[model samples]
Target: MTTYFTKDHEYLRVEGDTATVGITDYAQSQLGDVVFVELPAVGQSFKQGAEAAVVESVKAASDVYAPVSGEVVAVNDKLPDNPATINEDPEGAGWFMKIRLADKGELDKLMDEAAYKAMVG
Candidate 1:
């Protein structure tokens, strides 16, 4: 699997045609204690850079953008009942959704781990 990131701080873990989506660890840290997450429904299509989800924290509400254009296949249902999981594991059990990629080329436009690390720094 390969992972890519958007400048908006969302990550996409691609494995085959589907990719798992989530906000980055840096984003969760910046948000300061997640209170809720409004996730996209399965089968919903979105363009790259479009808002795919909404996360609310004690500090403020933030949008999680799509790192690539695709149709959502599934979403984590654990979030609404336990939003704090995002703060504890933003990249793992906290993943927001999975999407069937529309354009593989869009992944190339995103940041690699090194580039993302530098940008976050």
Candidate 2:
């Protein structure tokens, strides 16, 4: 799997044509104790950079944007009831959605781990 990151701090773990999407560890840290996540429905489509989910935390609510355009294939059902998982494992079990990519070329616009780290730094 190839992982790509957005400037907004979202991540896409791509495997073939599908990708798992989530907020980054840095983003969850910034949010400070996630309390809720409003996820996209399966089969729903989104454009690159569009609002795909909403994450609410003790600090504030933030939009989790679609790092690349795609149709939602799955969503993490565990998030609403166990939102703190976002803080504990933001990039693993804390993933928000899986999407069938609309265009793989869109990934070229994103950052790799190194570029992302430097940008965030």
The number of the candidate with the highest TM-score is 2
lDDT of 1 by residue, 69-110 (tens): 889999999898999999999999999999999999888888
lDDT (0 to 1) per candidate: 0.92, 0.94
TM-scores, one per candidate: 0.97, 0.98
Each prediction's Cα RMSD? 0.7, 0.6
Estimate the overall C-alpha local distance difference test score of candidate 1. Answer: 0.92
Clashing residue pairs in candidate 2 (N, C-alpha, C atoms within 3 angstroms): none
Worst 10 residues of 1 by lDDT: 59-68
The runs of at least 3 residues in candidate 2 whose Cα sits more than 4 Å from the true structure, single-residue gaps closed, are none
* Model 2 agreement with the true structure over 21-119: per-residue lDDT tens digits: 999999998899999899999999999878999999987999989888889999999898999999999999999999999999999999999999998
